[model samples]
Target: MTNFQQSEALSRVQPSTTLAVTQKARELKAAGRDIISLGAGEPDFDTPDFIKDAAIQAIRDGKTKYTAVDGIPELKQAVATKFKRDNNLDYDLDQISIAPGGKAILYNALVATMNPGDEVIIPAPYWVSYPDMALLAGGKPVIVKADASNGFKLSPEALEAVITPKTKWLIFNSPSNPTGAAYTHNEIKALTDVLLRYPHVMVMSDDMYEHIVYDGFEFATPAEVEPALYDRTLTVNGASKAFAMTGWRIGFAGGPKPMIKAMAKVMSQSTSNPSSISQWASVAALNGDQSFLKERNDAFKERRDLVVSMLNQANGLTCATPEGAFYVYPSCEGVIGKATPNGVKISSDEDFAAALLEDEGVAIVFGAAFGLSPYFRVSYAAAIEQLEDACQRIQRFCASLT
Candidate 1:
């Protein structure tokens, strides 16, 4: 067999560890192994019937032709309305752009702006795609760790410390993947205050988890909080997580017109305006009933609390309560240097994740994968019963350590 080589640009990035864990669990389950996967970040709910009907109607109407390079006018208007109605931000259609997914929207923007020596500041325990996308776009990722102690949220002081002449972008994700760490209004204000001083640095705010908050936490985006920084911030959102439309492949953002135009230019050469049907469905999703978001979030919050409590109860584990999102970042430091019943020593968080999976058939992403150490992420997006069983398996695995 001949070996196929990947490009140097592609080699700079690693495969998504969360998807890797999910795939491994799927493989084991296919082999008749009782595997429980907590690695998936997508919600466990179906798309609302109304949104599905929109797509069906679109297809029936023969609205499947190619649309605008960035997005159809109807979808762009809907996206603009969503931003204004929800985030209190004003973005004209020229300032709106759509892509196949949030991943595409982010990577394309980075590619459109980044130079070889450009730097993007990324808070650690971030969404898996941020740093890798920056690297793939020829920018250096400056990862500043936001550990469990601070709710896995980055500090204003940390943000200030990372800025340099070469700093080009700040990739921010609220209610972050792997850690459901949502920033409070005051917390976000502090960071924006720091950004006001760094005119050279732009912000890419990933508000994908804005609707998944708990405890009546008021969500705030960077641009909405600081008007002065508005021109430099890209407020990114999609129908994926909040609307339970992960497979729909529609992500849109509102930003400076220049940047939006540049991103659209890149999109024209690449994916060229996400699927037409998905765009129609997204227009419905953006403009339709948001009341259902609260109902789904209520379920997510319940699952989050359950997983947090159970993980905290596990021996050698300590899970911090998150304000929003359906994931937990738990520390496995106490279990380090310990040994399993089979005499395999636990060291890094990666070791703990592997042993737990091999011994108890539980799958989770390791902390190192998210640029941290001695911790792992658990996406509590599964059903209540499955989550309970997974937690019990995790507890049992921890107890087996000698």
Candidate 2:
């Protein structure tokens, strides 16, 4: 085999630990064993019929040709309208950039804006891709821990402590990946209050799960809550979680005109505008009536309740009732240092996950992968029956430990 010298930027990167367990679960499932997975990050629901019909119509109308580098005017207009109607923040067409997905849009922004040695502040238990993307873009990721004690919400004091002259971006995700933690309007305003003190620090708010909230919790964004930061904030969102369109490969963001132009420039050379058909479908998602969102969200809330309650009932597991998203980050501290019935020692969340997967065919991601410890993230994206079955297996596995 020929030895190759990878780029310095790539040398600093690591494969997504989250996807590693997910792939392991897939391998087991492919082998014909019954595996109930709680590792998924996306909604289990199918893409709405209206959005699918729009894609079909786009294909039939021969709109498959290459389009603009930034985004088609029609889709951008729809996104603008979405921001106005949902977040009450008005964005013009020129202020938006569309990409293959939320992750791609975020990477594009980092690549387009980050200079070498720039520091991007990221909270711990963040999405697996954020720090890696920043490193790939030649920026430094300065992580600040957000403990479970605070419901995984970042405090203004923590935000203030991290800012420096080199600080360039603050990456924020609401209804977060592993924790399903949503920041209230007041909590966000508190952080934004600190942000006002640092003019050099810009914000990238990832609102991918904005519609999956529960307990009458309304969603809020940086631009909407703190209008002053609106000029520097990149509000990124997509239909992947909200409209169950993960495979559609469409995500969009709105920000300052200069930042939007830089991001579009990167997109122009790289993955020129998102897929034409996907963009058309996104337009339908944004402009169409959103009554279906509530129905899907109700289903998600029910599943969340079922999974969270069942997991809490499991021995050695204490799950916090997440107010949004379809995930439960449960503390497994009680099981640590315990020995399995099979004589293997469960010293960490990873060990517990492996044992559970092998013994009970229940797949879960360890919380250490998300930068926390003694915890595991359980996705309730499966059906009610499957979720119940997984929880039963989990309880049994928990009981197997002594």
Candidate 3:
């Protein structure tokens, strides 16, 4: 027998529960169980033909060699143009760094700057990766709980209360994962006012879902909302969510030159540049026509409304209507303390999710995995028919609970 010990760094972070549940759904479906999965954080659409053609053309043109460590000059320029055209922020090529994905971009920033005992303020109901990334970087995650009452948003008061001498970064996401709650311009400015007082705290504005917003919701980033914080804010965006290019693995960000340089240094040591083909595809993605975005967003909006309406009808589930994104976070407190048909008691959010999965074969990520409990997150990124079936099963499961 051999004793194998994992590194402390490896032990600090848990496997992504979103991916875990998604994998479980796949396993069950493969085992002959009828499963409807609302667990993946990816869009259910295919990458547009234009982007795919770009990759094919790149391969045909022999553009498959390694380029710059951070990114190709063209992609960086595209990203810079995108910032100016979309976000009203001017960024030079040197201030931009590209990574394999938005998650990689975030991890690189944290790893490059974090020291032991550093703190990152992550709003609750955040994307599952935020806190774990902080932990992996040898920093403490200071979670600020922002529930339904606060529209799942961190208030200025809450933001001010959490800051300390050790606070290094504030990981901010709009149209957030799990909750799909996006902050208004005024809302973001309120928090930025607090950050202006704290010179040491930097901001990582994850705007990956910027184009997927709905109902004419104007998306605003922290740096865009407050120019005073631009020097310390890293505006991160990618083609994964918006362009339905998850497999492309292209994420880019603009920040201070020093921070961008440091992040590139980390990338140079790890996964150098993103795939050359993917980079070329991403260039087309960033620079090509964006007419398809609204069509996709319109589809997402319809699915979001359907899920919200149907989930609200489920007994004991109180769902909030989000302004953007393809997810709905519903409180499962009504289902807690109940029992399944097999007499399994549902106590925690995880328990409610497990019982639902076992009885109805509909998979969702439990809210506790997002730093909130007595709730669960449902991604409505599935097809209309699948969402209809999953919600029907959820209604049936709720009806059967004692």
Among these predictions, the greatest TM-score belongs to 3
**294-370: candidate 1 lDDT, tens digit per residue:** 99888988898899899999999998998888889999999999999999999899999999999999999999999
Q: Would you list the rank order by lDDT, best first?
A: 3, 1, 2
Q: Write the per-residue lDDT of candidate 3 for residues 6-122, one digit (tens) a residue.
A: 889879999999999999999999999999999999999999999999999999999999889999999999999999999999999999999999999999999999999999999
The RMSD (Cα, Å) of candidate 1 is 1.0
lDDT of 2 by residue, 228-343 (tens): 99998999998799989988889989999988999989988888878999999999999998999899888888888888888889989999988888888999999999988888
Which candidate leads the pack in lDDT?
3
Model 2: what TM-score? 0.98
Local distance difference test scores for all models: 0.92, 0.90, 0.94
Better of 1 and 3 by lDDT: 3
TM-score, structure 3 vs. true: 0.99
Output candidate 3 Cα RMSD. 0.8
Indicate the worst ten consecutive residues by lDDT in candidate 3: 1-10
